[model samples]
Target: MPLALRDAFIDLEQYERLCAAAGEGERLEYLDGEVVRMMVGGSTAHHALTRRLDGLIADRLAPGGPCAVFRETMRLEAGTARFYPDVFVACGAGVAPDAETRGVPGATVILEVLSPSTERYDRGRKWLRYQSLPDLRHFALVAQDQCRIEAFHRQAAGWHYELLVGPDAVLRLEAVGVELRLGEVYAVLPALAAGADDRPAQAAFTPAQVASIAAMRGLPVSGEIEALLAELEPDACAAAVAALVAGDGVGGWAAILPERLHARLNARPDDASERG
Candidate 1:
């Protein structure tokens, strides 16, 4: 059964009290004055990647350094909402301690491993809220099923985006003076076979099938496709692509697919050339 939120808006102190009474291992978050339940379990790939990234950050920072790395259990207070980033770093002075709550006032860097249920909130609402943190220098969104990461960093002009794809690529966190290779980041995960689908069998189409459809439609298969494929079952995946190819439009599929996937497919060039 899914966890249910209490029927009223909650303040930070009340939120902390609810967390304590709920006991350990019950993951929850406060968003827009509502205490929402986070997805309880994560895929093995998500867990592994998070742990590896945490270790990588910790090793780079070392003990008694200016910064420290913390995992998802740590709470972060940003504006009126609270988030438990997959992994984060706090630099200079340590986090302000609260006996009832755990998390830093502001994080130097924040990372989140995308999941099917939370991808929208992570990319949309959470992203907007995170940018407001005064100490945040970088924010990264990692894909669990593919070797890809999108990092956003603050710059003099404004925030800038950098995309890293493929196992050979490296993610450099210049703010914290550490670099991590995609290969290292994805280490220990089951190898995804060439032209094979990484999503569960229930999906409408596999990654390979999506690529084939894209090729037929004269569209290029992109990282966004891979990310979408990670969330869908074989049949639904195939149906979504087919709808786009047939020019019947994505309206019917939008009801069934994630908003992000719908937006990506909609943005593709209509005159795209077939991949050779």
Candidate 2:
């Protein structure tokens, strides 16, 4: 989600005051003289990717770790900008003891899970401002809609860019001496995985993807599904999976129903999405 700007302006000092008085779980950010309130509880894909990346980076580091991975809850200070990145890593004594509402001066690496609304700003001004942090060695933009990672590494000469795509690509974080596989990064997304191919039938529901969907829908994993898949016509099964991967889970289903029936159902929908 994108930040909602308030009708007010503040410097770094006033930003700290607001943060101190802000309620628990409330997150506020400052950039270019604007006070931005972040929208909490982003899409399922965003949270899933963040959780996976956090663990992947943290696990690879030593226990107690030379550098610690911080989630969105941690505040990061970059030159004149004060914002919370989705995932970041800071090394050594940058974190001050007894500092509660404060933040580390900078970070070794910063990452943001790109949302449709904020992708441009994140890759532009935010990325430019982050370059001021002397200790910042890497910055990465994680895509929530697909299996891709765009990274910028600081070199002695300047910055180098790298793009990693597909489930097989690996992201090398030399600053922290860790690597993240795209397969592991997108584990919860049923449509993508390590070594995934364009075989529509085979891609429909791999064992791991089936398990993930089952867990999400709270369905039991009996042998029945395997039997049912075998009994269904191959073309029909393929078409059904294609609908699911098409993005709108409901619209895909509606397209198959008789026009009259679909219209009636849409008028009185009772899906979980409607409840919210």
- Candidate 2: regions farther than 4 A off: 96-98, 194-276
* Candidate 2 lDDT by residue in tens digits, 151-179: 77777755666667788888888998988
Q: Which stretches of candidate 1 lie over 4 Å from their true place?
A: 1-7, 190-276
All candidates: TM-score: 0.67, 0.67
- Backbone clash tally (model 1): 12
Which ten-residue region of model 2 has the weakest summed lDDT? 201-210
- Where is model 1 poorest over a 10-residue stretch in terms of lDDT? 192-201
| lDDT, model 2, position 32 | 83
On lDDT, the candidate that comes out on top is: 1
